[model samples]
Target: MTALAAEAVRHDRELVARHAYGDPEAFDEVYARFSGLVFQIARRMSGDDALAEDLSQEIFLRIFRHLRGYQGRSSLKTWVYRVAINCCRSRLARRSRRERAFVAVEEGRLERVPSAAEGPQGRLRRREAAETVGRALNRLPLAFREAVVLRDVCGLSYEEIATVAGVRLGTVRSRIARGRDRLRLELERGSS
Candidate 1:
């Protein structure tokens, strides 16, 4: 492993130990270590950068508040993910009553379209395809999207995803399968 990887692993171990022993510095270290991951997950789930930032902060705050209740039943990383998913779910629930308005603005569009002068039309096509996939992901129901993101984007194993999602292992597999199927259909519609 690289020096950086080795250092990170060592730091994670030390921080976990110190936090378990009630060290405030260790809590700060944990926050710094996992905040980016939390933020990324939040952004993917909410599809809004501003809301994601707010949700990420709320997730970490909950983690700190509930740290004492952590029983080491799962890895700390998985537990952190569980908290993030719950935070995203709560945010989605609270917003469900409001109609989501999408503004038709140029800046909101993904920068995938190329100028007519660009010779590599294929590259532009690929970017458009990727943007389509992103849009389809954003449209999926929160539960399905969470499963897809956790299993595919974050590359978590099925067992880990099940634990983090608080679902049975079989349910995690089923949801991932169904989510992929739905996304594929959406992509096909977009392409046609």
Candidate 2:
């Protein structure tokens, strides 16, 4: 096996052992491993970096608190993702009721773009496309957005996604199909 793959397997075993033994350090390892995944899901769902950071922290806190209750029905990673998604959903619901604007950037002069190893023009186009996609994702309905983010961005299988979203497998598949179709239409419209 590849070195990275071997390392991942070792880490997974270590985490399970530590968690099962109630080792706090083992929980910290779990947090370090999955924190980025949590943050990205939170950021995508909330469309606000600050909110995402807060939600990521909250998810980790919940995971630490509930680690003992985890029954190992699903993978530990999937359980953590479920917690993150639920936390993001709760924050979204609260923010929707309050009608808060989730601006991604502050009002100021344009920031310097990253140095483009692919060339300036290609980089500009790529950046514009990314921004458009981000906006389109943010415009989607919360359920659809979460489906796409978990499936596409996080690369979760339909079964894993179903577990994370607390939905049936069929529902997860339908939502992902519809979400991709909607996003395609939005992108086509924007391009045209």
Candidate 3:
């Protein structure tokens, strides 16, 4: 490994050690740092806020279960992301089997208590765009969608993504490239 990569691995080892052996507070600190990232991955992958929240909570539960024994062969983020992705995949598969297939809730179709952070109009537009992109994303095959989310939205390095995906570096590159192209086409077509 490169020096930088080695340093990252060392850091993750130390952090995991701290969480495993230190006071309970150390685990809380780890949770605080990773929860948002976990939530983001869940939300983007599942395209459902409520489901994403549930998944995030479930992810944390799993993390706490396994964090104590992390082997440190990969960075902590990659390991957590792998867990998040696996959770999402299982949830999606179960949902699909339960129903014929999953369907996205239409944009602004969700009833919300109004918030002043942005006017209702602004929120609507943003929601619509998000819905459009999400619908487009959902149309992608899971492999392509995951590669896109992991690299583009979640911002993992190609090497990290390979570790998470259990694929080679070249495969990660191809998936990301193909995913981006598919996304572009979907956006232009405006229907999935």
lDDT of 2 by residue, 1-192 (tens): 578756755666667768878787888788788888988898889888998888888988888777767765666687788888888888888886666354323212222333335565876867876666776787677889999999888999998899889999999989999998987776766555
lDDT tens digits by residue: candidate 3, 26-142 = 678778889899999998887779989999999998998888889987778888999999888888778745654334433223323223255659778677666666667766677
Q: How many Å off is the CA of 8 in candidate 2?
A: 8.7
Cα RMSD, model 2: 5.9
For model 1, residues 1-192, the per-residue Cα lDDT tens digits are: 578756755655666667778899988877887888899899888877898889988999898888766765555688899999999998886774453454223224433333335576867776766666666677677889999999887899998898899999989989999999988876555444
Question: Which portions of model 3 miss their true places by more than 4 Å?
Answer: 1-8, 99-131
Candidates in order, TM-scores: namely: 0.78, 0.77, 0.76
Q: In model 3, which range of ten residues has the least summed lDDT?
A: 107-116
Worst 10 residues of 2 by lDDT: 104-113
lDDT of 1 at 150: 93
Model 1 weakest 10-residue run by lDDT = 103-112
Candidate with top lDDT is 3
lDDT of each: 0.78, 0.78, 0.79
CA displacement after TM-score superposition, residue 92 of candidate 1 (Å): 0.8
lDDT score, candidate 3: 0.79
